[model samples]
Target: METINARSWVERFIKTVVDQAGELTELDRRAGDGDYGTNLRSALRRVEANLAGVASDAPDAVFTAVSDGFLNTGGTSGPLFGMWFREFTRSPELTTAALAEAAAGGVAVVQRLGKAEVGHKTMVDAMVPAAEALTAAAGRDEPLAEAVRAAASAAHTGAASTESLLAKRGRASYVGENARGVVDPGALTVALFFDAAS
Candidate 1:
């Protein structure tokens, strides 16, 4: 199958996040400040609202609009995700391998900004594994849809793994051991992205 275009990917992600906003917020309440869902929903709404003015056939333009929308929103996730999508614009194409590298690039920016690692119980936990899975799938010559399916599966596993981890970053870190048994909302949000891609 062909790779999904930028507009379709963004629209699907916004729809998925909107549909799961309450669940995401509840997850955050268990271990975080309980605003992740709202923050993401608000950011995505902005992206959706601005999408109409962008070139429907231009992936770079669409991604830029999405980045701008997220960056304009108020939230840690907004800026981080905005940076993530912004990296996509640097790629000349959106093939599976290029997408994987773009995702890795985004993870690097998030890590640099957040000072968090894969085991830090942050979105990096899911994002790192998803990038790896995407890269591996690309190496195996998988189609874009199949590669993203692998990424989504890996992200889901990574998000679930956070349930057993002590928070080492973000507000949950303040909770220490008490953060265990609750999945990281950021990780779940990353999982949702790949899930929507699939």
Candidate 2:
């Protein structure tokens, strides 16, 4: 089987999101602003389309396309996605280690921007774990694709574990005790991206 490239990863992300938007939206409605899924879906389609012309071999190009597309689309998610791609752009080499580093950098930027940390029940919950998993896999000299898959799996587990956390950021934070036991919308969104990229 052929390993998926950056372009393929973006395509899969778009499709996965477009397919799961409604389900995610319903999940978000309970504890969030109820528009998380819709916001992601709309931004993803534009990013996906912008990426079609980018070369699969050009990881930086792909990241730039994602950043530009998301920024153009405009939303809280747009800037978040742009930050992620900006981190990705900092590395020119496309390797398992590079990908892991980029993911970690992206998580750092999000943490800085959102002023949230681990246990906040935000996307950082999933992203930080995913980046760690990827780094471990890279240290073990795993294939790039396999490392990404491991990271994605870890991200999903992190998202699920958010059910026990209290929201400390975003609209859900206002709910306080009522936010406990609810998985964060942003965490789920991160899981979706990792799943597709993997």
Find the candidate with the highest TM-score and give its number.
Answer: 1
Per-model CA lDDT versus the true structure? 0.85, 0.80
Top-scoring candidate (lDDT): 1
97: Cα error in model 2, Å: 1.0
For model 2, where is the 10-residue window of minimal lDDT?
69-78
Give a tens-digit lDDT track for model 1, residues 89-196.
776556788888888898899899989998889898999999999889889988888898899999999999999999888878987877899899889988988887
lDDT of 2 by residue, 118-170 (tens): 78888888888998998898899888878888988998899998889888777
Q: Per-prediction TM-score, please?
A: 0.94, 0.91
Q: Residue-pair clashes per candidate, as listed?
A: 0, 0
Following a full C-alpha superposition, what root-mean-square deviation does model 1 have from the true structure?
1.4
